[model samples]
Target: MPTSENTFHLGLTMAGAVSAGCYTSGVIDYLFEVLDLWEKAKRGNVQGIDQNLVPKHNVIIDAMGGTSAGGMTTIISTLYALKGKLKPVKKIPENPMENQNVLYDSWVHLDDNEEKTFKKIWDVDDLDGELTSLFNSKVIDAIATKALDMGGDVNDFESYVSENLPRFISKDLEILLSHTLLRGIPLSVDFKTEIARRLKNSPMHNTFEHYLVSHFKLNSGNPVNENSYLWFNPFKEKYSDKIKLSTISTGAFPIGLAYRKFDNTQFSDEYIKSVTRRVIFGDFGSENPDVNHDIELNNYPENYSSISVDGGAINNEPYREVGSILRSKFHKDENEYQNYGLIMIDPFPDNDDIERKYKEPKNLLKVVPAIIQTLWNQAKVKRKEMLEQYNHDFFKGVIYPIKHRIINGEYKGRDKNPIISASFNAFGGFLDVNFRVHDFFLGRNNARNFVQYFGCIPYDPDNGNVHPIHREWTNEMVEKFKVSRRGDERIFLPIIPDLNLLLEGKEPGDDKYNYTYKGKPKYNPSELFKLKDNIYNRFKKVLDKGFDSFGEKTEEESETPISDALIRREYRRNWFQRMGDNVKSWVVGKFKNPVKKAIASMLSKFVIKSILEDLEQMEVLDDKAN
Candidate 1:
């Protein structure tokens, strides 16, 4: 049985996008703030704040979910928290590089050039060498093992290839074969073993065993099972043992990474005969695993029959899962649901004109408009379906009202009403109409006195600006305005400062800042760097609170302090690793288009010729037998 904790239900879900890192960082920052506030309140340092406002550490998170890059963040955060290594929230410096260094120093302990260590391990000077070694060792070994099991030697395979496929033998073809092997078998047993070793000591091992839900796919085309979902229950020792490998398999994007396969032991007795040869695998993200649009939210069939695709197929947000879980708990009369909070960290671009574009698919070309219109309609239906899943009452009170207000001209134009007229209204009118009415109705005497004493001054219609009449008593109005402004500031309090800087159209401190790309601001490097810093700072702030500075270690601290050089080395190492992965992805992507065409053209000719040649050889063998 899985261990359960009675804690407040705090469900966190993140959206998929390049900016997911930034959004996740902001969430971590908010969590740190909550932790800080709680600690301060306990110590009686934070005035006017209740300690209960901050959730206890044990009960802080009931469930968390994410998709794509956000999924990676979710796992990392959960693991760190379980290990009791969550850092505090602190303000990052303005210098982008400095912030970058801080991030490097914190996570993945090593200097930038530390990736060179891999070179030492592999006895390779460059990435190509490393790849070549990986393919030879992992890919060739697997093939050789399989061949041996089938009662064939390496020489037998070479002889079969020589006699049956003469045209396929060439220097270029050999290299392509190696590359193909690399793609076909991306993950090695050794790599999986290493991951398992790491997880053995991980603080999150127990939580992973109990609560982690991994989405995976079984090969639909295979004879054993047409289509099946691998819903791994980590609580089971059998499943827990393969959690790390399962995570990688599910999360690996299909673009560059090959589909991972596992031996289907269920069919071993009937299908394999002597050896279990049946394998099943596919992309977990297929058909939107997060939402699974075809099925009811609560109904997870024992054998999932849908084709897997990218999680972004139905929706980028993975909050539906969290919401469903929480709703189920609520229905079960779980007390934690009463104090539940949902935090959705969305990093995707939020365009105000999205609904407008959906409604009016205007294009210069007629066909283009038609295609766009079709897509827009489809998206609208998907959105509606998603909205329907949530509680109608909660939706109306929270999300529906915002949508209605934004569309109903509430967000546009200045306040034309003759009540609570203020000079510093940037958003034109107050968002809360009831509050405006309450101010005027409750303080009618004050309003009358002000008007009678100073005289009413109407806003200029031509200028469309509110120009309040300046009077000696107007200073009081200004003071009141300032007080109101303070209340408004609270809404922006939890916003990540680095995100604010980016929104202001300023460079947030990237080392290799590109001015523009294709006539648009190219702030990718800076944005990602800031995101890394944000995540790192939050972890450092919370976990390493006793440390005087980043590199310094107190006598009481058990962990060794990292040096500046080591930080730089580790950062370089990570950069190189990322570069290698990107290059491999790009190469594989380029190979796909051309290779498909070439294979189609060649296969038509090669198949016929090879079959005839094999038949002739069989006739000669028959003559010799006679």
Candidate 2:
């Protein structure tokens, strides 16, 4: 509910990351906290709220779009935003040290009865008769359990025996095989069915449908003759449904490759070959694959109906959706909001590094999987290139490039765009509790840093006004700061001062006296004065409290999560490391329970001590600087 004179028409587009979406959820958790968008919605108020309200204040968002796993993020996050369930269960203290205590204490200390902080942000209650069902219910568990249970029917012992073993086999042998081969049926069909069923049952689903319908109405009458706000890339043209949007958007390979209900389409040999070529080489083939990209909604079948798959197969990063929607908004005379920006959050920035084997496949067995991987990698690379261009072109927006490691590399439009980096060890599996906890905190802390340094005011497009905690700088002011510090070499420093007197229209002279340049200077006198004043004011605002504290390390910035050591070292492990660890863990579990327990206990203590020492060392560094 934050109000701002420089309010932004924020449009968000998230990048897909399979299980790594836990990290993305953490990012959204913190963003919602800063925006203070946790107020619950009442009956009839949730739907059509964005259009009904006058163009007066920041609401939830102007447009919500993503692909594959990111599409799931859009649905889940938007659901939370609408239901007013985004606030953190634990209060974040004002004191930095106190905040650190909350973070570490929650993770390190044991609490079985109480829900973990990460689970709170990620889980929501199932909507039933209870009005507070969402408050107490855990969303991830509910959906996962239902998806697993109803996804496939349980196989009976007789059926299993008949399917896998010969009828002539001995009764005892058949029973043994049945017990060993006790697996359920294929889950893809059931999984999609479960997702649709849940959506249909929930009232929030109705609210979301209303929201989309309203957007469709607003975007329909435009002169461009295209829908502006809502989009999802289905494979074949079909009828659109609010319930199906979430399902279709998430129907990528592995998850929903056989989702053939809407189109009655089969993955024939020729169809796959053609699809692979387009996916791997892009629309124009390898020579000019990057140009004339064909995944935008504009290229969709003339009708709104279509059976879809994971949109990532076509466009992994749907940032163009933001651009397209904003353009439509800009052209619409009825649209009242002036300021606009895209908040593009990419969870899988490093996915381009997931390459296929450089050498040719050794056998026919590896060919199909290899081709699929090559296609995936090539598609990701193309979209990543497009994302880079999008960021450069839309330099007035906000960008969150979540990373697994902290680095000093300069991002595109650093001086123009409000780019905030949230780094942490995102190696934990998708449903890992420890990873979710650490990731949530990592996101929250970095969000605090964003508000402190960049001063991005969070605006909700569906809701009304909330005051901003701090002021944000305009592009002109930021450009001047870069110009004034043109010669400064320091990289880690957040703020830099003018290094040359000539830039300020002053002559370089001896220490004894100051000299003003009477001759024509490099810059206009008035411009130079304004630059100096801006730099001085920025320094006062950012660094007056303490220079050392300006860029002091937070938990995410300083060290990898403790869970990284205990659960998985990192996400980028090679096949050998993964196989070795699996074998080693199995061996230890089977033969050395005591040894495994001892190692875990010792490792936990060692990691905790190391973290404390590192934090203390940072404090000492701060003290010495002061």
Q: Write the per-residue lDDT of candidate 1 for residues 289-348, one digit (tens) a residue.
A: 333332211212232222222243234455545554444443333322243445565544
Q: Deviation in angstroms for 7 in model 2?
A: 3.3
* Best by the TM-score measure: 2
Worst 10 residues of 1 by lDDT: 171-180
Tens digits of lDDT, candidate 2, 1-626: 33434234456666655444544555565555434421222122233332221122333345655654455556555434333223453333333123222222222121213443223322222222222211122433333222222222323433333343221111121000000001111111123354566574432211000001112211111111122222211111221242243433352323212221221132222322232232333221121224454322212222222233445654556555444454444322332333445565665554334567567788988898998988767644454445646443332333343223212533323211111111112212221233334444444444434333333333332353222211243333233322212463321111111122212333212111111111111211232222333323322322222333543576665265686675564567899988999998788557654544454455435533443343233221122321
Clashes within 3 Å, all models in order: 23, 20
RMSD of each: 29.4, 25.1
Q: Which stretches of candidate 1 lie over 4 Å from their true place?
A: 1-8, 36-40, 43-59, 93-242, 249-309, 331-338, 349-626
lDDT of each: 0.30, 0.34
